[model samples]
Target: MIQAMYKRTKIGCEVLIQQAIDECPISTIKLYISRYYKKNNQRWALWARQHSPLLLQVTSTNSLESYHSELKRTTSSHYGLIGACHKVVALDQKQRTDSEYVAFEFRTKKISVMGLDDEILNEFHKFPYPIQRMLADEICAVENRIEKGKAIPGLTSLHCNCLFFIRYLLPCHHIFHEQIYGPTKLLTTNSWRNFQLMFEESGFEVYFHNELIEVDILEQTKAEKAAEN
Candidate 1:
Protein backbone atom coordinates (compact mmCIF):
# COMPACT_ATOMS: atom_id res chain seq x y z
CA MET A 1 0.00 0.00 0.00
CA ILE A 2 2.82 2.43 0.89
CA GLN A 3 4.62 1.56 -2.29
CA ALA A 4 1.48 1.97 -4.39
CA MET A 5 0.67 5.30 -2.77
CA TYR A 6 4.23 6.46 -3.38
CA LYS A 7 4.16 5.36 -7.00
CA ARG A 8 0.83 7.03 -7.61
CA THR A 9 2.13 10.35 -6.33
CA LYS A 10 5.56 10.17 -7.93
CA ILE A 11 4.46 9.02 -11.38
CA GLY A 12 4.23 12.48 -12.94
CA CYS A 13 5.30 14.71 -10.09
CA GLU A 14 8.34 16.08 -8.41
CA VAL A 15 8.25 15.91 -4.63
CA LEU A 16 10.63 17.70 -2.31
CA ILE A 17 11.55 15.73 0.80
CA GLN A 18 13.22 17.20 3.86
CA GLN A 19 16.84 16.52 4.60
CA ALA A 20 17.46 14.17 7.49
CA ILE A 21 18.33 15.89 10.77
CA ASP A 22 21.96 14.92 10.32
CA GLU A 23 21.88 15.93 6.66
CA CYS A 24 20.02 19.18 7.24
CA PRO A 25 22.13 22.11 6.09
CA ILE A 26 20.50 24.62 8.38
CA SER A 27 18.95 24.55 11.85
CA THR A 28 15.61 25.94 10.74
CA ILE A 29 13.53 24.30 8.01
CA LYS A 30 11.38 26.33 5.67
CA LEU A 31 7.99 25.02 4.54
CA TYR A 32 7.02 24.41 0.91
CA ILE A 33 3.48 25.04 -0.31
CA SER A 34 1.65 23.82 -3.41
CA ARG A 35 0.17 26.56 -5.64
CA TYR A 36 -2.17 24.74 -8.04
CA TYR A 37 -5.66 26.36 -8.18
CA LYS A 38 -8.06 23.38 -7.99
CA LYS A 39 -5.51 21.78 -5.68
CA ASN A 40 -6.32 24.57 -3.25
CA ASN A 41 -9.99 23.69 -2.93
CA GLN A 42 -11.59 20.51 -1.55
CA ARG A 43 -14.91 21.51 -3.17
CA TRP A 44 -14.25 18.95 -5.89
CA ALA A 45 -13.08 16.32 -3.39
CA LEU A 46 -15.49 13.79 -4.88
CA TRP A 47 -13.40 13.87 -8.04
CA ALA A 48 -10.19 13.09 -6.19
CA ARG A 49 -9.20 9.45 -6.32
CA GLN A 50 -6.06 7.40 -5.76
CA HIS A 51 -5.26 4.86 -8.46
CA SER A 52 -2.43 2.56 -9.47
CA PRO A 53 -0.08 4.21 -11.90
CA LEU A 54 1.28 0.76 -12.68
CA LEU A 55 -2.03 -0.17 -14.22
CA LEU A 56 -1.93 2.92 -16.37
CA GLN A 57 1.61 2.21 -17.50
CA VAL A 58 0.87 -1.24 -18.92
CA THR A 59 0.31 -1.26 -22.70
CA SER A 60 -3.31 -1.86 -23.70
CA THR A 61 -2.67 -5.14 -25.55
CA ASN A 62 -0.51 -6.74 -22.83
CA SER A 63 -2.69 -5.23 -20.09
CA LEU A 64 -5.89 -6.79 -21.43
CA GLU A 65 -4.05 -10.04 -22.10
CA SER A 66 -2.74 -10.11 -18.52
CA TYR A 67 -6.19 -9.30 -17.17
CA HIS A 68 -7.77 -12.11 -19.14
CA SER A 69 -4.98 -14.48 -18.11
CA GLU A 70 -5.46 -13.65 -14.47
CA LEU A 71 -9.20 -14.12 -14.77
CA LYS A 72 -8.66 -17.46 -16.46
CA ARG A 73 -6.23 -18.53 -13.74
CA THR A 74 -8.72 -17.90 -10.94
CA THR A 75 -9.43 -21.12 -9.08
CA SER A 76 -10.87 -22.49 -5.84
CA SER A 77 -7.55 -22.14 -4.07
CA HIS A 78 -9.08 -22.02 -0.63
CA TYR A 79 -5.78 -21.86 1.28
CA GLY A 80 -4.38 -19.09 -0.88
CA LEU A 81 -7.70 -17.27 -0.70
CA ILE A 82 -7.70 -17.49 3.09
CA GLY A 83 -4.11 -16.29 3.28
CA ALA A 84 -4.95 -13.38 1.01
CA CYS A 85 -7.91 -12.47 3.18
CA HIS A 86 -5.69 -12.54 6.27
CA LYS A 87 -3.14 -10.33 4.54
CA VAL A 88 -5.83 -7.84 3.60
CA VAL A 89 -7.14 -7.71 7.17
CA ALA A 90 -3.63 -7.22 8.52
CA LEU A 91 -2.87 -4.50 5.99
CA ASP A 92 -6.19 -2.77 6.65
CA GLN A 93 -5.59 -2.80 10.39
CA LYS A 94 -2.09 -1.46 9.89
CA GLN A 95 -3.19 1.33 7.54
CA ARG A 96 -6.13 2.27 9.76
CA THR A 97 -4.00 2.38 12.88
CA ASP A 98 -1.25 4.28 11.10
CA SER A 99 -3.60 6.92 9.70
CA GLU A 100 -5.40 7.30 13.02
CA TYR A 101 -2.24 7.57 15.04
CA VAL A 102 -0.68 9.88 12.49
CA ALA A 103 -3.77 12.05 12.59
CA PHE A 104 -3.65 12.01 16.37
CA GLU A 105 0.00 13.01 16.41
CA PHE A 106 -0.83 15.68 13.90
CA ARG A 107 -3.22 17.11 16.46
CA THR A 108 -0.93 16.52 19.42
CA LYS A 109 2.83 16.32 19.29
CA LYS A 110 3.57 14.64 22.57
CA ILE A 111 3.58 10.83 22.91
CA SER A 112 5.07 8.59 25.57
CA VAL A 113 6.54 5.09 25.38
CA MET A 114 7.88 3.00 28.28
CA GLY A 115 10.71 0.88 26.92
CA LEU A 116 13.70 1.87 24.75
CA ASP A 117 16.97 0.30 23.60
CA ASP A 118 19.67 0.34 20.98
CA GLU A 119 17.74 -1.98 18.65
CA ILE A 120 14.57 0.10 18.67
CA LEU A 121 16.57 3.31 18.44
CA ASN A 122 18.18 1.98 15.29
CA GLU A 123 14.94 0.78 13.72
CA PHE A 124 13.38 4.17 14.50
CA HIS A 125 15.91 5.91 12.32
CA LYS A 126 15.44 3.52 9.43
CA PHE A 127 11.70 3.81 8.72
CA PRO A 128 11.57 7.59 8.18
CA TYR A 129 12.37 7.96 4.48
CA PRO A 130 9.34 6.31 2.90
CA ILE A 131 7.27 7.66 5.75
CA GLN A 132 8.42 11.22 4.99
CA ARG A 133 7.93 10.71 1.27
CA MET A 134 4.43 9.38 1.68
CA LEU A 135 3.60 12.29 3.95
CA ALA A 136 5.08 14.81 1.53
CA ASP A 137 3.10 13.25 -1.27
CA GLU A 138 -0.14 13.33 0.71
CA ILE A 139 0.37 16.96 1.66
CA CYS A 140 0.85 17.82 -1.99
CA ALA A 141 -2.08 15.62 -2.96
CA VAL A 142 -4.60 17.34 -0.70
CA GLU A 143 -5.08 21.07 -1.15
CA ASN A 144 -8.78 21.27 -0.26
CA ARG A 145 -9.99 22.07 3.25
CA ILE A 146 -6.37 22.82 4.08
CA GLU A 147 -4.76 26.20 4.64
CA LYS A 148 -1.19 27.37 3.98
CA GLY A 149 -1.39 25.35 0.76
CA LYS A 150 1.33 22.92 1.87
CA ALA A 151 2.00 19.53 3.40
CA ILE A 152 2.78 20.81 6.86
CA PRO A 153 0.28 18.36 8.33
CA GLY A 154 1.97 15.51 6.59
CA LEU A 155 5.46 16.72 7.42
CA THR A 156 4.87 17.47 11.08
CA SER A 157 2.66 14.45 11.67
CA LEU A 158 5.09 12.16 9.94
CA HIS A 159 8.02 13.35 12.03
CA CYS A 160 6.10 13.28 15.31
CA ASN A 161 4.55 9.88 14.57
CA CYS A 162 7.94 8.50 13.64
CA LEU A 163 9.46 9.80 16.85
CA PHE A 164 6.52 8.74 19.04
CA PHE A 165 6.16 5.24 17.63
CA ILE A 166 9.87 4.62 17.65
CA ARG A 167 10.78 6.20 20.95
CA TYR A 168 7.68 5.40 22.98
CA LEU A 169 5.14 2.97 21.57
CA LEU A 170 7.59 0.40 20.21
CA PRO A 171 9.65 0.50 23.36
CA CYS A 172 6.60 0.22 25.62
CA HIS A 173 5.17 -2.69 23.62
CA HIS A 174 8.21 -4.55 22.31
CA ILE A 175 11.67 -3.70 23.64
CA PHE A 176 12.79 -4.28 27.21
CA HIS A 177 13.49 -1.17 29.27
CA GLU A 178 16.84 -2.69 30.23
CA GLN A 179 17.89 -2.56 26.57
CA ILE A 180 16.63 0.95 25.92
CA TYR A 181 16.76 2.77 29.23
CA GLY A 182 19.79 0.79 30.41
CA PRO A 183 20.26 1.70 34.10
CA THR A 184 17.67 4.46 34.22
CA LYS A 185 14.32 2.64 34.04
CA LEU A 186 15.51 -0.43 35.96
CA LEU A 187 14.91 -0.71 39.70
CA THR A 188 16.75 -3.18 41.88
CA THR A 189 14.92 -4.76 44.84
CA ASN A 190 16.88 -2.58 47.24
CA SER A 191 16.10 0.50 45.19
CA TRP A 192 12.41 -0.30 45.07
CA ARG A 193 12.34 -1.03 48.75
CA ASN A 194 14.13 2.20 49.48
CA PHE A 195 11.68 4.07 47.29
CA GLN A 196 8.74 2.46 49.05
CA LEU A 197 10.25 3.33 52.41
CA MET A 198 10.72 6.91 51.32
CA PHE A 199 7.16 7.02 50.02
CA GLU A 200 5.81 5.67 53.31
CA GLU A 201 7.96 8.11 55.28
CA SER A 202 6.59 10.89 53.14
CA GLY A 203 3.01 9.83 54.04
CA PHE A 204 2.24 8.35 50.63
CA GLU A 205 0.28 5.07 50.75
CA VAL A 206 1.98 2.13 49.09
CA TYR A 207 0.71 -1.46 49.36
CA PHE A 208 3.67 -3.55 48.19
CA HIS A 209 5.30 -4.11 51.58
CA ASN A 210 4.42 -7.79 51.77
CA GLU A 211 5.93 -8.47 48.36
CA LEU A 212 9.01 -6.47 49.29
CA ILE A 213 9.38 -8.43 52.55
CA GLU A 214 9.24 -11.69 50.60
CA VAL A 215 11.93 -10.47 48.24
CA ASP A 216 14.09 -9.34 51.16
CA ILE A 217 13.71 -12.67 52.89
CA LEU A 218 14.59 -14.60 49.71
CA GLU A 219 17.67 -12.46 49.21
CA GLN A 220 18.79 -12.96 52.82
CA THR A 221 18.19 -16.69 52.64
CA LYS A 222 20.25 -17.03 49.49
CA ALA A 223 23.12 -15.04 51.03
CA GLU A 224 23.06 -17.10 54.27
CA LYS A 225 23.04 -20.42 52.39
CA ALA A 226 25.99 -19.33 50.23
CA ALA A 227 27.98 -18.14 53.26
CA GLU A 228 27.52 -21.47 55.06
CA ASN A 229 28.96 -23.36 52.05
Candidate 2:
Protein backbone atom coordinates (compact mmCIF):
# COMPACT_ATOMS: atom_id res chain seq x y z
CA MET A 1 0.00 0.00 0.00
CA ILE A 2 2.79 2.40 0.89
CA GLN A 3 4.68 1.66 -2.30
CA ALA A 4 1.56 1.98 -4.44
CA MET A 5 0.67 5.31 -2.85
CA TYR A 6 3.62 6.98 -4.57
CA LYS A 7 1.80 7.07 -7.95
CA ARG A 8 -1.46 8.33 -6.47
CA THR A 9 -2.42 11.97 -6.11
CA LYS A 10 -2.00 13.81 -2.78
CA ILE A 11 -5.56 13.18 -1.66
CA GLY A 12 -5.49 9.58 -2.87
CA CYS A 13 -2.27 8.98 -0.98
CA GLU A 14 -3.74 10.46 2.18
CA VAL A 15 -6.86 8.33 1.95
CA LEU A 16 -4.89 5.12 1.41
CA ILE A 17 -2.45 5.92 4.23
CA GLN A 18 -5.20 6.80 6.66
CA GLN A 19 -7.01 3.55 5.93
CA ALA A 20 -3.87 1.47 6.38
CA ILE A 21 -2.85 3.34 9.51
CA ASP A 22 -6.24 2.79 11.13
CA GLU A 23 -6.46 -0.86 10.19
CA CYS A 24 -2.86 -1.83 10.95
CA PRO A 25 -2.55 -4.47 13.66
CA ILE A 26 1.15 -3.83 14.24
CA SER A 27 2.08 -0.83 16.33
CA THR A 28 5.52 -0.71 14.71
CA ILE A 29 4.04 -0.32 11.22
CA LYS A 30 1.67 2.37 12.44
CA LEU A 31 4.58 4.20 14.08
CA TYR A 32 6.60 3.90 10.89
CA ILE A 33 3.76 5.37 8.88
CA SER A 34 3.19 8.24 11.27
CA ARG A 35 6.87 9.00 11.75
CA TYR A 36 8.32 8.56 8.26
CA TYR A 37 5.61 8.46 5.60
CA LYS A 38 3.38 11.06 7.18
CA LYS A 39 6.23 13.41 7.98
CA ASN A 40 7.67 13.67 4.46
CA ASN A 41 4.53 12.88 2.54
CA GLN A 42 4.52 16.17 0.68
CA ARG A 43 7.48 15.11 -1.42
CA TRP A 44 5.60 12.05 -2.69
CA ALA A 45 3.08 14.02 -4.75
CA LEU A 46 2.73 13.30 -8.52
CA TRP A 47 4.35 16.74 -8.94
CA ALA A 48 7.46 15.50 -10.72
CA ARG A 49 5.50 13.21 -13.05
CA GLN A 50 3.78 15.96 -15.04
CA HIS A 51 5.23 15.88 -18.55
CA SER A 52 7.26 18.82 -19.87
CA PRO A 53 9.78 19.41 -22.64
CA LEU A 54 12.73 19.04 -20.28
CA LEU A 55 11.40 16.06 -18.35
CA LEU A 56 9.48 14.03 -20.99
CA GLN A 57 7.57 11.24 -19.17
CA VAL A 58 10.03 11.24 -16.28
CA THR A 59 8.95 10.27 -12.80
CA SER A 60 12.27 11.45 -11.29
CA THR A 61 15.76 12.75 -12.03
CA ASN A 62 17.07 9.43 -13.31
CA SER A 63 16.23 10.26 -16.93
CA LEU A 64 17.67 13.78 -16.56
CA GLU A 65 20.85 12.32 -15.05
CA SER A 66 21.06 9.81 -17.84
CA TYR A 67 20.60 12.62 -20.40
CA HIS A 68 23.41 14.64 -18.79
CA SER A 69 25.69 11.60 -18.86
CA GLU A 70 24.87 11.09 -22.50
CA LEU A 71 25.79 14.71 -23.17
CA LYS A 72 29.15 14.19 -21.49
CA ARG A 73 29.72 10.97 -23.45
CA THR A 74 28.92 12.71 -26.74
CA THR A 75 31.06 15.81 -26.22
CA SER A 76 34.63 16.25 -24.94
CA SER A 77 36.41 18.94 -22.91
CA HIS A 78 38.85 19.33 -25.85
CA TYR A 79 35.94 20.42 -28.07
CA GLY A 80 35.97 23.88 -26.38
CA LEU A 81 33.01 26.33 -26.37
CA ILE A 82 31.99 26.39 -30.04
CA GLY A 83 32.24 22.65 -30.76
CA ALA A 84 30.51 21.75 -27.46
CA CYS A 85 27.63 24.14 -28.19
CA HIS A 86 27.12 22.57 -31.61
CA LYS A 87 27.12 19.01 -30.17
CA VAL A 88 24.73 19.98 -27.36
CA VAL A 89 22.29 21.62 -29.74
CA ALA A 90 22.46 18.66 -32.07
CA LEU A 91 21.70 16.27 -29.23
CA ASP A 92 18.79 18.41 -28.06
CA GLN A 93 17.41 18.60 -31.57
CA LYS A 94 17.68 14.85 -32.10
CA GLN A 95 15.95 14.17 -28.77
CA ARG A 96 13.06 16.49 -29.60
CA THR A 97 12.75 15.06 -33.09
CA ASP A 98 12.64 11.53 -31.74
CA SER A 99 9.96 12.58 -29.28
CA GLU A 100 7.92 14.09 -32.08
CA TYR A 101 8.34 11.00 -34.25
CA VAL A 102 7.14 8.67 -31.51
CA ALA A 103 4.16 10.96 -30.84
CA PHE A 104 3.29 11.03 -34.52
CA GLU A 105 3.50 7.26 -34.81
CA PHE A 106 1.22 6.77 -31.87
CA ARG A 107 -1.29 9.27 -33.19
CA THR A 108 -1.44 7.64 -36.61
CA LYS A 109 -1.45 4.03 -35.44
CA LYS A 110 -4.85 2.46 -34.91
CA ILE A 111 -5.07 1.31 -31.31
CA SER A 112 -6.23 -2.33 -31.25
CA VAL A 113 -6.22 -3.28 -27.61
CA MET A 114 -8.55 -2.90 -24.58
CA GLY A 115 -11.65 -3.93 -26.55
CA LEU A 116 -11.58 -0.75 -28.63
CA ASP A 117 -13.29 -1.39 -31.96
CA ASP A 118 -12.31 0.09 -35.27
CA GLU A 119 -15.45 2.18 -35.09
CA ILE A 120 -14.38 3.66 -31.79
CA LEU A 121 -10.95 4.38 -33.24
CA ASN A 122 -12.69 6.10 -36.14
CA GLU A 123 -14.66 8.23 -33.70
CA PHE A 124 -11.45 9.23 -31.95
CA HIS A 125 -9.82 9.95 -35.30
CA LYS A 126 -12.58 12.40 -36.22
CA PHE A 127 -11.52 14.84 -33.50
CA PRO A 128 -9.20 17.69 -34.49
CA TYR A 129 -5.46 17.34 -34.02
CA PRO A 130 -5.32 19.21 -30.72
CA ILE A 131 -8.32 17.40 -29.31
CA GLN A 132 -6.89 14.05 -30.41
CA ARG A 133 -3.61 14.91 -28.73
CA MET A 134 -5.44 15.76 -25.54
CA LEU A 135 -7.23 12.40 -25.63
CA ALA A 136 -4.09 10.38 -26.33
CA ASP A 137 -3.11 9.94 -22.71
CA GLU A 138 -6.63 9.06 -21.75
CA ILE A 139 -6.89 6.49 -24.53
CA CYS A 140 -3.68 4.81 -23.42
CA ALA A 141 -5.09 4.42 -19.92
CA VAL A 142 -8.46 3.05 -21.03
CA GLU A 143 -7.30 -0.50 -20.40
CA ASN A 144 -6.28 0.36 -16.88
CA ARG A 145 -9.66 1.97 -16.27
CA ILE A 146 -11.36 -1.13 -17.62
CA GLU A 147 -9.33 -3.28 -15.27
CA LYS A 148 -10.27 -1.12 -12.27
CA GLY A 149 -13.85 -0.72 -13.52
CA LYS A 150 -14.92 2.72 -14.70
CA ALA A 151 -15.09 5.26 -11.88
CA ILE A 152 -18.47 6.37 -10.62
CA PRO A 153 -18.68 10.14 -10.13
CA GLY A 154 -15.19 9.88 -8.70
CA LEU A 155 -13.71 12.28 -6.14
CA THR A 156 -15.70 15.52 -6.43
CA SER A 157 -18.17 13.94 -8.89
CA LEU A 158 -17.55 15.10 -12.47
CA HIS A 159 -13.93 13.92 -12.73
CA CYS A 160 -11.71 11.29 -11.20
CA ASN A 161 -9.05 12.01 -8.58
CA CYS A 162 -6.27 10.80 -10.88
CA LEU A 163 -3.20 12.95 -11.54
CA PHE A 164 -3.92 13.32 -15.28
CA PHE A 165 -7.27 15.11 -14.91
CA ILE A 166 -6.00 17.18 -11.98
CA ARG A 167 -3.01 18.32 -14.02
CA TYR A 168 -4.78 18.92 -17.38
CA LEU A 169 -8.39 19.66 -16.33
CA LEU A 170 -9.67 17.54 -19.24
CA PRO A 171 -11.49 14.23 -19.18
CA CYS A 172 -9.43 11.49 -17.60
CA HIS A 173 -9.78 7.92 -18.88
CA HIS A 174 -12.63 7.35 -16.44
CA ILE A 175 -14.91 10.17 -17.49
CA PHE A 176 -13.66 9.97 -21.06
CA HIS A 177 -15.49 6.68 -21.45
CA GLU A 178 -18.50 8.94 -21.96
CA GLN A 179 -16.85 11.07 -24.64
CA ILE A 180 -20.01 10.76 -26.67
CA TYR A 181 -21.32 13.51 -24.40
CA GLY A 182 -18.61 15.80 -25.82
CA PRO A 183 -15.29 16.79 -24.19
CA THR A 184 -13.55 18.38 -27.17
CA LYS A 185 -14.58 21.83 -25.97
CA LEU A 186 -12.47 21.49 -22.84
CA LEU A 187 -9.42 20.69 -24.93
CA THR A 188 -9.94 23.68 -27.27
CA THR A 189 -11.13 26.39 -24.86
CA ASN A 190 -8.64 29.23 -24.30
CA SER A 191 -8.70 28.61 -20.56
CA TRP A 192 -7.34 25.07 -21.00
CA ARG A 193 -5.49 25.37 -24.34
CA ASN A 194 -2.23 26.13 -22.59
CA PHE A 195 -2.32 22.81 -20.70
CA GLN A 196 -4.51 20.23 -22.45
CA LEU A 197 -1.79 19.35 -24.91
CA MET A 198 1.79 18.84 -23.78
CA PHE A 199 3.43 22.23 -23.16
CA GLU A 200 6.86 23.48 -24.23
CA GLU A 201 6.92 20.83 -26.93
CA SER A 202 9.11 22.90 -29.24
CA GLY A 203 11.11 24.96 -26.71
CA PHE A 204 12.16 25.12 -23.07
CA GLU A 205 10.94 28.51 -21.86
CA VAL A 206 7.28 28.22 -20.78
CA TYR A 207 4.62 30.94 -20.52
CA PHE A 208 0.84 31.20 -20.80
CA HIS A 209 -0.84 33.87 -22.97
CA ASN A 210 -4.42 32.68 -22.45
CA GLU A 211 -5.45 34.64 -19.37
CA LEU A 212 -6.12 37.87 -21.31
CA ILE A 213 -9.39 36.62 -22.87
CA GLU A 214 -11.62 35.80 -19.89
CA VAL A 215 -14.15 38.43 -20.98
CA ASP A 216 -14.32 36.96 -24.47
CA ILE A 217 -14.70 33.49 -23.01
CA LEU A 218 -17.57 34.64 -20.80
CA GLU A 219 -19.27 36.27 -23.76
CA GLN A 220 -18.79 33.18 -25.89
CA THR A 221 -20.27 31.04 -23.14
CA LYS A 222 -23.20 33.32 -22.39
CA ALA A 223 -25.26 31.02 -24.61
CA GLU A 224 -25.40 28.69 -21.58
CA LYS A 225 -27.93 31.10 -20.16
CA ALA A 226 -30.38 30.40 -22.99
CA ALA A 227 -33.13 29.48 -20.53
CA GLU A 228 -32.97 33.04 -19.10
CA ASN A 229 -34.18 34.34 -22.45
Top model number, TM-score: 2
lDDT per residue, candidate 2, 1-229, as tens digits? 6453455456677777778789899999999988877667665544333332222223468767977988989998799899999999999998899879866765455433355555545555544344455566676676666678664333333455565565444567766554433333232234333442443353212322221123576765787677577
Tens digits of per-residue lDDT for model 1, 133-210: 332333233333234442222221112222222221122211122322233433343433443243233221122221
Model 1 lowest lDDT segment of ten: 166-175
Quote each prediction's TM-score. 0.17, 0.43
The weakest ten consecutive residues by lDDT in model 2 span 203-212
For residue 201, model 1's alpha carbon misses the true position, in angstroms, by 51
Task: Spell out the clash pairs found in candidate 2.
Answer: none
